[model samples]
Target: MSEPAAPADTIPHGDPFAIFEDWFAEARVTEPNDPNAMALATATPDGRPSVRMVLLKGHGPDGFVFYTNFESRKGHELAANGHVALLFHWKSLRRQIRIEGPISEVTPAEADAYFASRHPESRLGSAASDQSRPLENRQVYLDRVAAVRALYPDGNVPRPAHWSGYCVRPEAIEFWHDREFRLHERRRFVQSADGGWTSTMLYP
Candidate 1:
Protein backbone atom coordinates (compact mmCIF):
# COMPACT_ATOMS: atom_id res chain seq x y z
CA MET A 1 0.00 0.00 0.00
CA SER A 2 1.13 3.60 -0.58
CA GLU A 3 2.05 5.78 2.33
CA PRO A 4 -0.29 8.46 3.60
CA ALA A 5 0.08 11.92 2.19
CA ALA A 6 2.09 14.47 4.07
CA PRO A 7 0.35 17.14 6.10
CA ALA A 8 -0.34 20.34 4.17
CA ASP A 9 1.61 22.45 6.64
CA THR A 10 4.72 20.41 5.91
CA ILE A 11 4.95 21.37 2.26
CA PRO A 12 8.39 22.77 1.63
CA HIS A 13 8.70 26.47 0.95
CA GLY A 14 11.44 28.39 -0.88
CA ASP A 15 14.01 27.03 -3.32
CA PRO A 16 11.59 25.29 -5.65
CA PHE A 17 14.43 23.35 -7.21
CA ALA A 18 15.26 21.81 -3.88
CA ILE A 19 11.67 20.81 -3.37
CA PHE A 20 11.66 19.31 -6.85
CA GLU A 21 14.73 17.24 -6.11
CA ASP A 22 13.21 15.95 -2.88
CA TRP A 23 9.94 14.96 -4.47
CA PHE A 24 11.70 13.52 -7.49
CA ALA A 25 13.85 11.34 -5.28
CA GLU A 26 10.73 9.98 -3.61
CA ALA A 27 9.12 9.44 -6.99
CA ARG A 28 12.06 7.35 -8.13
CA VAL A 29 11.35 4.98 -5.28
CA THR A 30 7.57 4.76 -5.65
CA GLU A 31 6.78 5.15 -9.33
CA PRO A 32 6.28 1.75 -10.94
CA ASN A 33 8.01 2.83 -14.14
CA ASP A 34 9.54 5.78 -15.92
CA PRO A 35 9.76 8.10 -12.96
CA ASN A 36 11.72 10.48 -15.12
CA ALA A 37 9.06 10.61 -17.82
CA MET A 38 7.49 14.04 -18.30
CA ALA A 39 4.86 15.49 -20.60
CA LEU A 40 6.43 18.02 -22.94
CA ALA A 41 3.99 20.52 -24.45
CA THR A 42 4.86 22.57 -27.47
CA ALA A 43 2.96 24.80 -29.81
CA THR A 44 3.14 25.79 -33.44
CA PRO A 45 3.82 29.41 -34.37
CA ASP A 46 0.10 29.98 -34.82
CA GLY A 47 -0.88 28.31 -31.52
CA ARG A 48 -1.60 24.71 -32.36
CA PRO A 49 -0.56 22.80 -29.26
CA SER A 50 0.64 19.25 -28.84
CA VAL A 51 1.88 17.23 -25.90
CA ARG A 52 3.87 14.03 -25.68
CA MET A 53 5.85 12.09 -23.14
CA VAL A 54 9.62 12.49 -23.06
CA LEU A 55 12.16 11.28 -20.63
CA LEU A 56 13.94 13.81 -18.43
CA LYS A 57 17.48 13.07 -19.45
CA GLY A 58 19.04 15.63 -17.13
CA HIS A 59 17.97 18.40 -14.79
CA GLY A 60 19.14 20.72 -12.10
CA PRO A 61 18.73 24.34 -11.08
CA ASP A 62 19.88 25.18 -14.62
CA GLY A 63 16.86 23.45 -16.20
CA PHE A 64 15.35 20.21 -17.39
CA VAL A 65 16.73 18.58 -20.50
CA PHE A 66 15.40 16.25 -23.20
CA TYR A 67 16.79 15.27 -26.56
CA THR A 68 15.09 14.64 -29.89
CA ASN A 69 15.50 15.05 -33.60
CA PHE A 70 15.50 18.76 -34.33
CA GLU A 71 13.53 18.07 -37.50
CA SER A 72 10.68 16.33 -35.66
CA ARG A 73 7.31 17.96 -35.03
CA LYS A 74 8.00 19.05 -31.47
CA GLY A 75 11.49 20.05 -32.50
CA HIS A 76 10.22 22.20 -35.33
CA GLU A 77 7.63 23.73 -33.04
CA LEU A 78 10.30 24.49 -30.49
CA ALA A 79 12.48 26.08 -33.12
CA ALA A 80 9.69 28.45 -34.08
CA ASN A 81 8.48 29.07 -30.53
CA GLY A 82 11.11 28.94 -27.84
CA HIS A 83 8.57 28.60 -25.06
CA VAL A 84 7.22 25.30 -23.72
CA ALA A 85 5.53 23.65 -20.77
CA LEU A 86 6.43 20.46 -18.98
CA LEU A 87 4.39 18.29 -16.65
CA PHE A 88 5.65 15.65 -14.29
CA HIS A 89 2.93 13.49 -12.79
CA TRP A 90 3.73 10.74 -10.32
CA LYS A 91 0.54 8.86 -9.53
CA SER A 92 2.16 6.75 -6.85
CA LEU A 93 2.87 9.90 -4.90
CA ARG A 94 -0.22 11.77 -6.02
CA ARG A 95 1.93 14.70 -6.99
CA GLN A 96 2.55 16.65 -10.15
CA ILE A 97 4.75 19.54 -11.13
CA ARG A 98 4.09 21.99 -13.94
CA ILE A 99 6.87 24.07 -15.46
CA GLU A 100 6.67 26.90 -17.94
CA GLY A 101 9.78 28.14 -19.63
CA PRO A 102 11.79 29.10 -22.65
CA ILE A 103 14.17 26.62 -24.20
CA SER A 104 17.75 26.78 -25.41
CA GLU A 105 19.76 24.14 -27.19
CA VAL A 106 22.10 21.94 -25.24
CA THR A 107 25.73 21.93 -26.28
CA PRO A 108 26.83 19.54 -29.01
CA ALA A 109 29.19 17.93 -26.54
CA GLU A 110 26.29 17.16 -24.26
CA ALA A 111 24.30 15.63 -27.09
CA ASP A 112 27.21 13.50 -28.23
CA ALA A 113 27.89 12.23 -24.70
CA TYR A 114 24.25 11.28 -24.12
CA PHE A 115 23.90 9.61 -27.50
CA ALA A 116 27.00 7.58 -26.83
CA SER A 117 25.61 6.43 -23.49
CA ARG A 118 22.46 4.90 -24.93
CA HIS A 119 22.19 1.14 -25.45
CA PRO A 120 23.64 -0.03 -28.77
CA GLU A 121 20.25 -0.90 -30.24
CA SER A 122 18.73 2.35 -28.96
CA ARG A 123 21.54 4.26 -30.56
CA LEU A 124 20.97 2.50 -33.86
CA GLY A 125 17.22 3.01 -33.74
CA SER A 126 17.44 6.72 -33.00
CA ALA A 127 20.11 7.23 -35.63
CA ALA A 128 17.92 5.50 -38.22
CA SER A 129 14.65 7.20 -37.36
CA ASP A 130 13.21 10.02 -39.42
CA GLN A 131 11.07 11.21 -36.56
CA SER A 132 7.66 12.76 -37.18
CA ARG A 133 7.86 11.71 -40.80
CA PRO A 134 5.48 9.35 -42.56
CA LEU A 135 6.78 5.86 -43.13
CA GLU A 136 5.65 3.53 -45.89
CA ASN A 137 5.97 0.45 -43.70
CA ARG A 138 7.71 -1.07 -40.70
CA GLN A 139 10.04 -2.98 -42.95
CA VAL A 140 11.36 0.23 -44.40
CA TYR A 141 12.34 1.48 -40.98
CA LEU A 142 13.79 -1.88 -40.10
CA ASP A 143 15.83 -1.79 -43.27
CA ARG A 144 17.09 1.68 -42.44
CA VAL A 145 18.09 0.50 -39.00
CA ALA A 146 19.76 -2.51 -40.57
CA ALA A 147 21.61 -0.33 -43.01
CA VAL A 148 22.90 1.96 -40.27
CA ARG A 149 23.78 -1.03 -38.14
CA ALA A 150 25.72 -2.55 -40.98
CA LEU A 151 27.77 0.61 -41.39
CA TYR A 152 28.57 0.71 -37.67
CA PRO A 153 28.44 -2.88 -36.50
CA ASP A 154 30.02 -1.81 -33.22
CA GLY A 155 26.98 0.46 -32.70
CA ASN A 156 29.10 3.60 -32.52
CA VAL A 157 26.53 5.43 -34.61
CA PRO A 158 27.28 9.12 -34.90
CA ARG A 159 24.64 11.47 -33.53
CA PRO A 160 22.78 13.02 -36.40
CA ALA A 161 23.37 16.75 -36.84
CA HIS A 162 19.67 17.28 -36.37
CA TRP A 163 19.53 15.29 -33.15
CA SER A 164 20.08 17.32 -30.00
CA GLY A 165 18.70 18.40 -26.67
CA TYR A 166 16.98 21.45 -25.28
CA CYS A 167 17.04 22.89 -21.80
CA VAL A 168 13.88 24.50 -20.45
CA ARG A 169 14.77 27.57 -18.43
CA PRO A 170 11.73 27.72 -16.23
CA GLU A 171 10.08 31.04 -15.51
CA ALA A 172 7.40 29.53 -13.34
CA ILE A 173 6.96 26.25 -11.54
CA GLU A 174 3.86 24.98 -9.74
CA PHE A 175 3.73 22.00 -7.47
CA TRP A 176 0.51 20.22 -6.57
CA HIS A 177 -0.12 17.58 -3.94
CA ASP A 178 -3.30 15.61 -3.72
CA ARG A 179 -5.12 15.29 -0.42
CA GLU A 180 -8.27 13.68 0.83
CA PHE A 181 -11.84 15.04 0.77
CA ARG A 182 -11.31 16.65 -2.63
CA LEU A 183 -9.04 19.28 -1.17
CA HIS A 184 -5.51 19.78 -2.43
CA GLU A 185 -2.40 21.84 -1.76
CA ARG A 186 -0.76 24.03 -4.34
CA ARG A 187 2.16 26.44 -4.48
CA ARG A 188 3.50 28.32 -7.43
CA PHE A 189 6.96 29.82 -7.75
CA VAL A 190 7.76 32.47 -10.32
CA GLN A 191 11.25 33.63 -11.08
CA SER A 192 12.07 37.14 -10.04
CA ALA A 193 14.12 39.64 -12.00
CA ASP A 194 16.90 39.29 -9.48
CA GLY A 195 17.27 35.64 -10.37
CA GLY A 196 15.49 34.38 -7.29
CA TRP A 197 11.98 33.03 -6.94
CA THR A 198 8.81 34.39 -5.38
CA SER A 199 6.18 31.91 -4.31
CA THR A 200 2.49 32.07 -3.50
CA MET A 201 -0.09 29.57 -2.42
CA LEU A 202 -3.15 28.94 -4.51
CA TYR A 203 -6.58 27.80 -3.42
CA PRO A 204 -7.12 24.18 -4.32
Candidate 2:
Protein backbone atom coordinates (compact mmCIF):
# COMPACT_ATOMS: atom_id res chain seq x y z
CA MET A 1 0.00 0.00 0.00
CA SER A 2 1.16 3.52 -0.74
CA GLU A 3 1.70 5.82 2.19
CA PRO A 4 -0.37 8.99 2.42
CA ALA A 5 1.57 12.13 1.70
CA ALA A 6 3.31 13.39 4.84
CA PRO A 7 2.16 17.03 4.87
CA ALA A 8 -1.51 16.27 3.89
CA ASP A 9 -1.39 19.12 1.29
CA THR A 10 -1.40 16.57 -1.50
CA ILE A 11 -5.17 16.57 -1.32
CA PRO A 12 -5.10 20.34 -0.78
CA HIS A 13 -8.60 20.93 0.55
CA GLY A 14 -10.22 21.27 3.96
CA ASP A 15 -13.66 19.97 3.07
CA PRO A 16 -13.84 16.32 4.14
CA PHE A 17 -17.10 15.76 2.30
CA ALA A 18 -15.59 16.56 -1.08
CA ILE A 19 -12.52 14.55 -0.27
CA PHE A 20 -14.68 11.57 0.71
CA GLU A 21 -16.46 11.77 -2.63
CA ASP A 22 -13.18 11.78 -4.47
CA TRP A 23 -11.92 8.77 -2.54
CA PHE A 24 -15.18 6.91 -3.09
CA ALA A 25 -15.02 7.61 -6.79
CA GLU A 26 -11.57 6.14 -6.94
CA ALA A 27 -12.62 3.15 -4.84
CA ARG A 28 -15.33 2.37 -7.35
CA VAL A 29 -12.59 1.51 -9.81
CA THR A 30 -10.18 -0.25 -7.46
CA GLU A 31 -12.29 -1.95 -4.83
CA PRO A 32 -13.54 -5.46 -5.51
CA ASN A 33 -16.86 -4.95 -3.71
CA ASP A 34 -19.05 -2.43 -1.96
CA PRO A 35 -16.65 0.46 -1.72
CA ASN A 36 -19.44 2.26 0.07
CA ALA A 37 -19.41 -0.22 2.95
CA MET A 38 -19.01 1.42 6.34
CA ALA A 39 -18.90 0.27 9.91
CA LEU A 40 -21.63 2.13 11.76
CA ALA A 41 -21.33 2.55 15.53
CA THR A 42 -24.35 3.45 17.58
CA ALA A 43 -24.71 3.71 21.33
CA THR A 44 -27.47 3.22 23.82
CA PRO A 45 -28.81 6.00 26.03
CA ASP A 46 -26.64 4.56 28.79
CA GLY A 47 -23.59 4.62 26.49
CA ARG A 48 -23.27 0.95 25.55
CA PRO A 49 -21.88 0.82 22.00
CA SER A 50 -22.74 -1.47 19.12
CA VAL A 51 -21.11 -1.59 15.72
CA ARG A 52 -22.19 -3.22 12.50
CA MET A 53 -21.46 -3.11 8.83
CA VAL A 54 -23.85 -1.14 6.65
CA LEU A 55 -23.81 -0.04 3.08
CA LEU A 56 -23.66 3.70 2.53
CA LYS A 57 -26.39 4.64 0.07
CA GLY A 58 -26.00 8.39 -0.26
CA HIS A 59 -23.62 11.20 0.50
CA GLY A 60 -23.66 14.95 -0.02
CA PRO A 61 -23.05 18.23 1.71
CA ASP A 62 -25.94 17.40 4.02
CA GLY A 63 -24.53 14.09 5.31
CA PHE A 64 -24.32 10.34 4.72
CA VAL A 65 -27.42 8.20 4.27
CA PHE A 66 -28.22 4.51 4.75
CA TYR A 67 -31.44 2.52 4.82
CA THR A 68 -32.73 -0.01 7.33
CA ASN A 69 -35.72 -1.11 9.33
CA PHE A 70 -36.82 1.63 11.71
CA GLU A 71 -37.53 -0.91 14.46
CA SER A 72 -34.18 -2.64 14.40
CA ARG A 73 -31.70 -2.51 17.27
CA LYS A 74 -29.66 0.17 15.53
CA GLY A 75 -32.79 2.16 14.91
CA HIS A 76 -33.86 1.93 18.54
CA GLU A 77 -30.42 3.01 19.68
CA LEU A 78 -30.24 5.91 17.27
CA ALA A 79 -33.68 7.02 18.32
CA ALA A 80 -32.69 7.11 21.96
CA ASN A 81 -29.26 8.69 21.54
CA GLY A 82 -29.44 10.62 18.27
CA HIS A 83 -25.72 10.25 17.70
CA VAL A 84 -23.49 7.83 15.77
CA ALA A 85 -20.03 7.22 14.45
CA LEU A 86 -19.11 5.62 11.11
CA LEU A 87 -15.87 4.27 9.76
CA PHE A 88 -14.96 3.49 6.16
CA HIS A 89 -11.79 1.59 5.51
CA TRP A 90 -10.59 1.04 1.95
CA LYS A 91 -7.92 -1.60 1.98
CA SER A 92 -7.00 -0.93 -1.63
CA LEU A 93 -6.01 2.60 -0.73
CA ARG A 94 -4.78 1.97 2.81
CA ARG A 95 -7.02 4.76 4.01
CA GLN A 96 -9.76 5.14 6.58
CA ILE A 97 -12.39 7.76 7.18
CA ARG A 98 -14.24 8.16 10.47
CA ILE A 99 -17.24 10.35 11.09
CA GLU A 100 -19.16 11.31 14.21
CA GLY A 101 -22.48 13.06 13.96
CA PRO A 102 -26.12 13.52 14.75
CA ILE A 103 -28.52 10.96 13.32
CA SER A 104 -32.00 11.70 11.96
CA GLU A 105 -34.53 10.00 9.77
CA VAL A 106 -34.66 10.99 6.15
CA THR A 107 -37.97 12.13 4.74
CA PRO A 108 -40.39 9.34 3.93
CA ALA A 109 -40.57 10.46 0.32
CA GLU A 110 -36.81 10.31 -0.02
CA ALA A 111 -36.72 6.88 1.57
CA ASP A 112 -39.43 5.70 -0.77
CA ALA A 113 -37.50 6.85 -3.79
CA TYR A 114 -34.34 5.09 -2.73
CA PHE A 115 -36.16 1.97 -1.62
CA ALA A 116 -37.92 1.75 -4.95
CA SER A 117 -34.58 1.81 -6.69
CA ARG A 118 -33.49 -1.36 -4.88
CA HIS A 119 -33.72 -4.82 -6.46
CA PRO A 120 -37.14 -6.38 -6.12
CA GLU A 121 -35.89 -9.25 -4.01
CA SER A 122 -34.16 -6.92 -1.58
CA ARG A 123 -37.33 -4.87 -1.26
CA LEU A 124 -39.27 -8.02 -0.52
CA GLY A 125 -36.74 -9.17 2.02
CA SER A 126 -36.90 -5.82 3.76
CA ALA A 127 -40.63 -6.20 4.11
CA ALA A 128 -40.49 -9.84 5.19
CA SER A 129 -37.90 -9.73 7.91
CA ASP A 130 -38.28 -7.90 11.19
CA GLN A 131 -34.61 -7.22 11.66
CA SER A 132 -32.95 -7.66 15.05
CA ARG A 133 -36.01 -9.53 16.29
CA PRO A 134 -35.82 -13.03 17.74
CA LEU A 135 -37.18 -15.89 15.68
CA GLU A 136 -38.35 -19.26 16.97
CA ASN A 137 -36.19 -21.06 14.46
CA ARG A 138 -34.64 -20.88 11.01
CA GLN A 139 -37.70 -22.57 9.56
CA VAL A 140 -39.92 -19.81 10.87
CA TYR A 141 -37.75 -17.23 9.15
CA LEU A 142 -37.88 -19.27 5.96
CA ASP A 143 -41.65 -19.38 6.28
CA ARG A 144 -41.76 -15.62 6.37
CA VAL A 145 -39.64 -15.47 3.26
CA ALA A 146 -41.97 -17.89 1.57
CA ALA A 147 -44.90 -15.75 2.49
CA VAL A 148 -43.30 -12.65 1.12
CA ARG A 149 -42.37 -14.51 -2.05
CA ALA A 150 -45.96 -15.61 -2.47
CA LEU A 151 -47.24 -12.07 -2.01
CA TYR A 152 -44.73 -10.58 -4.46
CA PRO A 153 -44.44 -13.40 -6.91
CA ASP A 154 -44.12 -11.08 -9.84
CA GLY A 155 -41.10 -9.44 -8.20
CA ASN A 156 -42.68 -6.02 -7.68
CA VAL A 157 -42.35 -5.30 -3.99
CA PRO A 158 -43.09 -1.99 -2.32
CA ARG A 159 -41.09 -0.50 0.49
CA PRO A 160 -42.48 -1.28 3.92
CA ALA A 161 -43.68 1.53 6.20
CA HIS A 162 -41.33 0.28 8.91
CA TRP A 163 -38.35 0.56 6.60
CA SER A 164 -36.63 3.87 5.81
CA GLY A 165 -33.40 5.75 5.55
CA TYR A 166 -31.32 7.61 8.12
CA CYS A 167 -28.89 10.44 7.58
CA VAL A 168 -25.85 11.23 9.69
CA ARG A 169 -25.15 14.94 9.72
CA PRO A 170 -21.52 14.95 10.67
CA GLU A 171 -19.99 17.23 13.26
CA ALA A 172 -16.56 15.78 12.55
CA ILE A 173 -14.81 13.76 9.84
CA GLU A 174 -11.36 12.31 10.28
CA PHE A 175 -9.10 10.91 7.56
CA TRP A 176 -6.33 8.44 8.25
CA HIS A 177 -3.51 7.24 6.06
CA ASP A 178 -1.15 4.46 7.03
CA ARG A 179 2.56 5.05 6.88
CA GLU A 180 5.77 3.09 7.49
CA PHE A 181 7.00 2.51 11.06
CA ARG A 182 3.52 3.08 12.45
CA LEU A 183 3.74 6.81 11.84
CA HIS A 184 0.30 7.15 10.29
CA GLU A 185 -1.10 10.53 9.36
CA ARG A 186 -4.35 11.68 10.88
CA ARG A 187 -6.27 14.80 9.96
CA ARG A 188 -9.56 15.83 11.48
CA PHE A 189 -12.10 18.11 9.85
CA VAL A 190 -14.56 19.63 12.28
CA GLN A 191 -17.65 21.58 11.42
CA SER A 192 -17.40 25.18 12.49
CA ALA A 193 -20.18 27.29 13.97
CA ASP A 194 -20.37 29.23 10.69
CA GLY A 195 -20.97 25.99 8.72
CA GLY A 196 -17.47 25.43 7.44
CA TRP A 197 -14.90 22.68 8.03
CA THR A 198 -11.67 23.37 9.87
CA SER A 199 -8.85 20.86 9.45
CA THR A 200 -6.23 20.02 12.03
CA MET A 201 -3.44 17.46 12.13
CA LEU A 202 -3.19 14.82 14.87
CA TYR A 203 -0.26 12.75 15.99
CA PRO A 204 -0.41 9.13 14.96
Candidate 3:
Protein backbone atom coordinates (compact mmCIF):
# COMPACT_ATOMS: atom_id res chain seq x y z
CA MET A 1 0.00 0.00 0.00
CA SER A 2 1.09 3.58 -0.62
CA GLU A 3 2.06 5.81 2.26
CA PRO A 4 -0.16 8.69 3.31
CA ALA A 5 0.64 12.25 2.27
CA ALA A 6 2.17 14.72 4.65
CA PRO A 7 -0.02 17.21 6.45
CA ALA A 8 -1.42 20.05 4.39
CA ASP A 9 0.41 22.55 6.56
CA THR A 10 3.62 21.18 5.21
CA ILE A 11 2.86 22.74 1.85
CA PRO A 12 5.19 25.70 1.51
CA HIS A 13 3.90 29.25 1.44
CA GLY A 14 5.52 30.50 -1.74
CA ASP A 15 4.86 31.06 -5.40
CA PRO A 16 1.77 29.13 -6.46
CA PHE A 17 3.34 28.36 -9.82
CA ALA A 18 6.29 26.74 -8.10
CA ILE A 19 3.96 24.67 -5.96
CA PHE A 20 2.00 23.64 -9.04
CA GLU A 21 5.15 22.44 -10.77
CA ASP A 22 6.09 20.30 -7.80
CA TRP A 23 2.63 18.72 -7.61
CA PHE A 24 2.50 18.17 -11.36
CA ALA A 25 5.88 16.45 -11.29
CA GLU A 26 4.68 14.07 -8.62
CA ALA A 27 1.42 13.42 -10.52
CA ARG A 28 3.38 12.49 -13.65
CA VAL A 29 4.98 9.63 -11.71
CA THR A 30 1.87 8.42 -9.86
CA GLU A 31 -1.01 8.82 -12.32
CA PRO A 32 -1.98 5.61 -14.08
CA ASN A 33 -3.21 7.39 -17.22
CA ASP A 34 -3.06 10.79 -18.89
CA PRO A 35 -1.66 12.89 -16.09
CA ASN A 36 -2.11 16.04 -18.14
CA ALA A 37 -5.83 15.59 -18.68
CA MET A 38 -7.94 18.47 -17.38
CA ALA A 39 -11.57 19.50 -17.44
CA LEU A 40 -12.20 22.76 -19.33
CA ALA A 41 -15.29 24.73 -18.38
CA THR A 42 -16.55 27.35 -20.79
CA ALA A 43 -19.73 29.38 -20.72
CA THR A 44 -21.87 30.97 -23.38
CA PRO A 45 -22.37 34.71 -23.47
CA ASP A 46 -25.74 34.25 -21.82
CA GLY A 47 -24.17 32.42 -18.87
CA ARG A 48 -25.02 28.87 -19.92
CA PRO A 49 -22.14 26.61 -18.93
CA SER A 50 -20.56 23.52 -20.48
CA VAL A 51 -17.52 21.37 -19.71
CA ARG A 52 -15.41 18.69 -21.39
CA MET A 53 -12.08 16.98 -20.96
CA VAL A 54 -8.99 18.28 -22.74
CA LEU A 55 -5.28 17.59 -22.48
CA LEU A 56 -2.84 20.17 -21.17
CA LYS A 57 -0.31 20.74 -23.89
CA GLY A 58 1.69 23.37 -22.00
CA HIS A 59 1.78 25.42 -18.81
CA GLY A 60 3.89 27.90 -16.92
CA PRO A 61 3.67 31.22 -15.06
CA ASP A 62 2.12 32.65 -18.24
CA GLY A 63 -0.78 30.16 -18.31
CA PHE A 64 -2.03 26.76 -19.44
CA VAL A 65 -2.50 25.78 -23.07
CA PHE A 66 -4.77 23.41 -25.01
CA TYR A 67 -5.65 22.95 -28.65
CA THR A 68 -9.03 22.46 -30.33
CA ASN A 69 -11.05 23.27 -33.43
CA PHE A 70 -11.77 26.97 -33.51
CA GLU A 71 -15.32 26.32 -34.74
CA SER A 72 -16.23 23.83 -32.06
CA ARG A 73 -18.82 24.60 -29.38
CA LYS A 74 -16.17 25.34 -26.77
CA GLY A 75 -14.24 27.46 -29.19
CA HIS A 76 -17.29 29.48 -30.10
CA GLU A 77 -18.08 30.00 -26.44
CA LEU A 78 -14.53 31.09 -25.74
CA ALA A 79 -14.65 33.65 -28.52
CA ALA A 80 -17.88 35.04 -27.15
CA ASN A 81 -16.77 34.89 -23.53
CA GLY A 82 -13.10 34.85 -22.67
CA HIS A 83 -13.61 33.92 -19.04
CA VAL A 84 -13.22 30.22 -18.25
CA ALA A 85 -12.29 27.70 -15.58
CA LEU A 86 -10.19 24.53 -15.56
CA LEU A 87 -9.96 21.57 -13.20
CA PHE A 88 -7.22 18.97 -12.76
CA HIS A 89 -8.14 15.94 -10.68
CA TRP A 90 -5.50 13.32 -9.87
CA LYS A 91 -7.32 10.40 -8.29
CA SER A 92 -4.12 8.64 -7.30
CA LEU A 93 -3.04 11.64 -5.25
CA ARG A 94 -6.48 12.54 -3.90
CA ARG A 95 -5.87 16.09 -5.06
CA GLN A 96 -7.38 18.57 -7.50
CA ILE A 97 -6.54 22.02 -8.81
CA ARG A 98 -8.99 24.64 -10.03
CA ILE A 99 -8.03 27.52 -12.27
CA GLU A 100 -10.10 30.45 -13.48
CA GLY A 101 -8.90 32.72 -16.24
CA PRO A 102 -9.41 34.51 -19.51
CA ILE A 103 -8.15 32.85 -22.67
CA SER A 104 -6.34 34.11 -25.75
CA GLU A 105 -5.45 32.37 -28.95
CA VAL A 106 -1.94 31.03 -29.28
CA THR A 107 0.34 32.26 -32.03
CA PRO A 108 -0.16 30.70 -35.44
CA ALA A 109 3.42 29.49 -35.37
CA GLU A 110 2.81 27.65 -32.12
CA ALA A 111 -0.28 26.01 -33.55
CA ASP A 112 1.56 24.87 -36.66
CA ALA A 113 4.40 23.41 -34.63
CA TYR A 114 2.09 21.41 -32.37
CA PHE A 115 -0.08 20.27 -35.28
CA ALA A 116 2.96 19.04 -37.15
CA SER A 117 4.04 16.99 -34.12
CA ARG A 118 0.75 15.07 -33.97
CA HIS A 119 0.58 11.52 -35.31
CA PRO A 120 -0.26 11.36 -39.00
CA GLU A 121 -3.58 9.64 -38.33
CA SER A 122 -4.52 12.20 -35.67
CA ARG A 123 -3.65 15.05 -37.99
CA LEU A 124 -5.86 13.57 -40.71
CA GLY A 125 -8.76 13.09 -38.31
CA SER A 126 -8.58 16.65 -37.03
CA ALA A 127 -8.26 18.07 -40.49
CA ALA A 128 -11.31 16.12 -41.67
CA SER A 129 -13.56 16.76 -38.70
CA ASP A 130 -16.27 19.39 -38.61
CA GLN A 131 -16.26 19.52 -34.88
CA SER A 132 -19.55 20.06 -32.97
CA ARG A 133 -21.52 19.45 -36.15
CA PRO A 134 -24.10 16.72 -36.55
CA LEU A 135 -23.01 13.59 -38.42
CA GLU A 136 -25.40 11.57 -40.54
CA ASN A 137 -23.48 8.38 -39.80
CA ARG A 138 -20.11 7.03 -38.79
CA GLN A 139 -19.39 6.03 -42.37
CA VAL A 140 -19.72 9.63 -43.51
CA TYR A 141 -17.01 10.75 -41.09
CA LEU A 142 -14.82 7.83 -42.03
CA ASP A 143 -15.24 8.72 -45.69
CA ARG A 144 -14.20 12.28 -44.99
CA VAL A 145 -11.14 11.02 -43.18
CA ALA A 146 -10.29 8.83 -46.14
CA ALA A 147 -10.69 11.75 -48.53
CA VAL A 148 -8.33 13.85 -46.45
CA ARG A 149 -5.88 11.02 -46.35
CA ALA A 150 -6.03 10.74 -50.16
CA LEU A 151 -5.36 14.46 -50.59
CA TYR A 152 -2.33 14.33 -48.31
CA PRO A 153 -1.06 10.88 -49.15
CA ASP A 154 2.12 11.50 -47.19
CA GLY A 155 -0.03 12.55 -44.20
CA ASN A 156 1.54 16.02 -44.17
CA VAL A 157 -1.81 17.57 -43.30
CA PRO A 158 -1.70 21.33 -42.95
CA ARG A 159 -3.19 22.83 -39.83
CA PRO A 160 -6.57 24.18 -40.79
CA ALA A 161 -7.19 27.88 -40.13
CA HIS A 162 -9.94 26.85 -37.74
CA TRP A 163 -7.74 24.41 -35.83
CA SER A 164 -5.53 26.08 -33.25
CA GLY A 165 -4.71 26.49 -29.58
CA TYR A 166 -5.63 28.77 -26.66
CA CYS A 167 -3.73 29.90 -23.59
CA VAL A 168 -5.58 30.70 -20.39
CA ARG A 169 -4.14 33.61 -18.39
CA PRO A 170 -5.11 32.52 -14.92
CA GLU A 171 -6.51 35.03 -12.47
CA ALA A 172 -7.21 32.56 -9.71
CA ILE A 173 -5.90 29.13 -8.77
CA GLU A 174 -7.09 26.90 -5.96
CA PHE A 175 -5.52 23.70 -4.69
CA TRP A 176 -7.46 21.03 -2.82
CA HIS A 177 -6.04 18.03 -0.99
CA ASP A 178 -8.19 15.32 0.57
CA ARG A 179 -7.45 13.97 4.03
CA GLU A 180 -8.80 11.26 6.29
CA PHE A 181 -12.01 11.83 8.27
CA ARG A 182 -13.32 14.11 5.52
CA LEU A 183 -11.07 16.89 6.66
CA HIS A 184 -9.71 18.51 3.54
CA GLU A 185 -7.22 21.31 2.95
CA ARG A 186 -7.78 24.09 0.45
CA ARG A 187 -5.66 27.03 -0.68
CA ARG A 188 -6.71 29.72 -3.07
CA PHE A 189 -4.45 32.15 -4.90
CA VAL A 190 -5.70 35.22 -6.73
CA GLN A 191 -3.78 37.61 -8.92
CA SER A 192 -3.46 41.11 -7.51
CA ALA A 193 -3.72 44.40 -9.37
CA ASP A 194 0.06 44.75 -9.52
CA GLY A 195 0.42 41.41 -11.29
CA GLY A 196 1.37 39.44 -8.21
CA TRP A 197 -0.47 36.59 -6.50
CA THR A 198 -2.11 36.62 -3.08
CA SER A 199 -3.13 33.42 -1.40
CA THR A 200 -5.22 32.28 1.53
CA MET A 201 -6.26 29.03 3.12
CA LEU A 202 -9.89 27.98 3.13
CA TYR A 203 -11.71 25.90 5.70
CA PRO A 204 -12.31 22.49 4.23
Per-candidate local distance difference test: 0.94, 0.88, 0.94
In model 2, where is the ten-residue run with the lowest total lDDT?
4-13
lDDT of 3 by residue, 12-40 (tens): 56798998898899999999999999999
lDDT of 1 by residue, 12-95 (tens): 778999999999999999999999999999999999999999999999999999999999999889999999999999999999
TM-scores of all predicted structures: 0.95, 0.92, 0.95
Model 2, CA-based lDDT: 0.88
> Relative to the unseen true structure, what is the C-alpha lDDT of residue 135 in candidate 1, on a scale of 0 to 100?
100
Model 3 residue pairs with clashes: none
- Between prediction 2 and prediction 3, the one with superior TM-score is 3
Candidate 2 accuracy as TM-score: 0.92
Candidate 1 whole-model C-alpha lDDT, 0 to 1: 0.94
Number of backbone collisions per candidate: 0, 0, 0
Number of backbone clashes in candidate 2:
0
Which digits, one per residue and each the tens of the lDDT, describe model 2 over residues 1-204? 996666634443567877898888988888999999999999999999999999999999899999998899998998899999999999998889999999889998999899889988788778889899998898887788789989888987778888998999999999888876777888899999999989988887
